[model samples]
Target: MTSIISAVPACPQAPQAPQAPEVPQALLAVEGAGLTVPVVGGGVVEYANLDYAASAPCLSDVAEHVARVLPYSASVHRGAGFASQVCTSLYEGARRDVARFVGARDGDLVVFTRNTTDAVNLLARALPATAGGVVLVDLEHHANLLPWRGGGRRGTGDVRCVATQPTLEATLDALAAELRAAPVALLAVTGASNVTGETPPLARLARMAHDAGARFFVDAAQLAPHRPVDMAALGIDYLAFSGHKLYAPFGAGVLVGPADWLDSAAPYLAGGGAVREVSTTGVDWATGPARHEAGTPNLAGATAIAAACRVLTALPPGAWERHETVLRDRLLRGLGALDDVVIHRIWPDGGEPVGVVTFSLRRHDPALVSAFLSAEHGIGVRAGRFCAHPLLARLGAPGGALRASVGVGTTVAHIDRLLDALATYLRVGPGWGYAHRDGQWQPTPDDRRPPAWVEQYA
Candidate 1:
């Protein structure tokens, strides 16, 4: 059998370098890049944050951007003060920045929400009554799945979960078959699996959905931060992503899409700003994005997202992709060399994955391994079903699995440290005892304390 290492290309084409006006230095520096963590032996090691799939640390530039706007923070939409006017302009300008960043089509509306879940729920509420059904695959995050299943106004559309095939082409074909067989009004799919980081054939799936008279939606919580997304170019009717996962941890998310369904549907939240007029007997509703974005929005969150988007756009064309690929390959090859390691994947041929890698050792509990890595090796990773229980069950790890995800801040040393920690655990058992508590494996007699700054702030 050919080794996976041999199958990888020796020399892939380098990504195009950025032209003049390089990325901001602040954007390049991630907060908590050199954080220190205490090990079990009373020694501290530099923390390796490899759980980027969940939530990434804030980018320095995003933080700076927020600081710059903090002084002028005021009520948006309807205020008489000068601060309010500036704040409103900044908020609206952020909407424009995000629209352009995602390549939104002309007239497309961008609605600000709390997070991707909120954005998807908003879309669910906006589903028109004429829509027939919603089609998605089993390999979706809960955010993408539950909204279509139990959410939506009128609760009219029937939900169908298509099984993912062993190959990307086969999975797309199955989705096409389902779309052809039913009157699918919407097809919601993940841009990339948060668990395995497997990227589906998004463009093909969008084409298929549109050809079958269904609108396509992408849960880009994972994809948007890793790669560029063009709504018009990919034929995506809608897209939802969170700033927390995009190096802007400001509790903001976006839903960028067409206006017809949203404008026709009732406002997501009824409040002072979302209404046109109100009387004792009746009320008139506002149209456009204002119809949905009801109260005072997260002005800072929106600004942070826009700032991060600008930083990403300024980066060399393929620099992020190339950098991540090298790290991913290194991690995969290192894990492959371990005889006791087992890498879990969806496709049989081991299709290309993003920065996330999920696997388990032959004789170790996933949670225990995760705890050991953190407590002894100062490595942070996610260990659980990763919110995609169906996919994990299908992958034969019904209990759970461990996932190590990378991002712009991840370094080759971090990946190596994780691999070395796992190898050490396999060769020699954990140095400390671990027990499952509150559904998570925690070290016994844990004595970890907050950093000095945290204590002072608290």
Candidate 2:
């Protein structure tokens, strides 16, 4: 008997849109291949992780890379088995990958540290005693600022912090004057601002520092994740950045560039990886990355970081910028249209920035605003001083302002939710009997409709 099987229906697939199905994870994330983490709320809130200037979630691809290598976790370099040999190869390979990722010298040292904080601290301590003077920016994050400050405290050098200006022209002029004033040995600067998302004129600053007989050190913790950072092209003598901020979030970082300061100065930490010999009379140190690393390095973290970099570099650079620009412009336009809200240096002009934006509303404490958004709207945002105490102080932000940072994961819907919640708060006043406490304004229950004066953003 000729039996015919019933025809099976094709599995339903989402209809393709004209432009990649509208990129549900937002433009940046979609372009960067970054993934979003789900919240407990009903609507899937794409993680508007503008705090990428601080830290970013590990890319899904990097996580996969880490998983694939998990089964072969063996001691590297101190090989005893096949697994050890494989682990060592991967570790060294990761170094080469990271070096290329940042456009470092072919043979440059790539030391793996815990994070940017550790990397900067390593460089700070590793500077030779002869390097008696260092210039740093006042707007630097504590990770960058405190290291030099601590170095001065340890009597290593006289750390001079150059005061910053709100405008770039004024900043460059002041920096030039400062560099000309003395025999500067090192100039430490942020490639981009974590608060205002402003990036200084890197190539110009590099030339100025070099001309003034100083080595330029770039704290690229915020810049690397967004754009291409070529150490040689920028003429940067030393560069530091964290894996966490670069979509790896793997307990590791990179300290790349000149080897002289790292080679001659006393090791930052001393233990297994840094030494070649140890005795009562003397201790012989290993050369290159191992010298600074000293202790057991996080091999997995380094490999994962390399994996994340590979994923990021695969995308078209222009696409990354274009996607973020759309989101940034949307944020600026929306925030600007709102009544009583002031957007700081709103997009395109004030300085070359990334997707991060900061703003404040009239009579609203930033802390309360941030807390309310989290509690009621399921919008996760950051508020208060964003670690750079001096910068905030300079901005006259006595209590700080609410910061909404966008990353690869941020979507237009996220911005809309933020705008909606703010409007609701302004119109209805506080809800659920929220009251100000100890100098903070508290929210009180009121009619759902907010005050009439509150305006809607286009």
lDDT per model, in order? 0.84, 0.72
Winner by lDDT: 1
Candidate 1 RMSD to the correct structure: 7.4
Over 1-458, each residue of candidate 1 has an lDDT whose tens digit, in order, gives 21111011122222222222222122267999898998875878999999999999998888999999999999997889999999999899999999998999999999999999999999998898778899989989999998877645544868899997878778877888899997989999999889888887777888888898999999999999888889999899999999999999999999999999999888999887889999998879998888988888899999999999998888988888877787777777777777567888888643456888899776567877888889889999999899999999988888898999988888877887887777667665676766666667777667777778999989
lDDT of 2 by residue, 408-450 (tens): 6666677666777676666654343445556553334322332
Clashes of each: 0, 13
Pairs of colliding residues, candidate 1: none
Candidate 2 residue runs with Cα over 4 Å from true position: 1-50, 151-156, 346-350, 433-458
Number of clashing residue pairs, candidate 1:
0
Off by over 4 Å in 1: 1-27, 349-352, 452-458
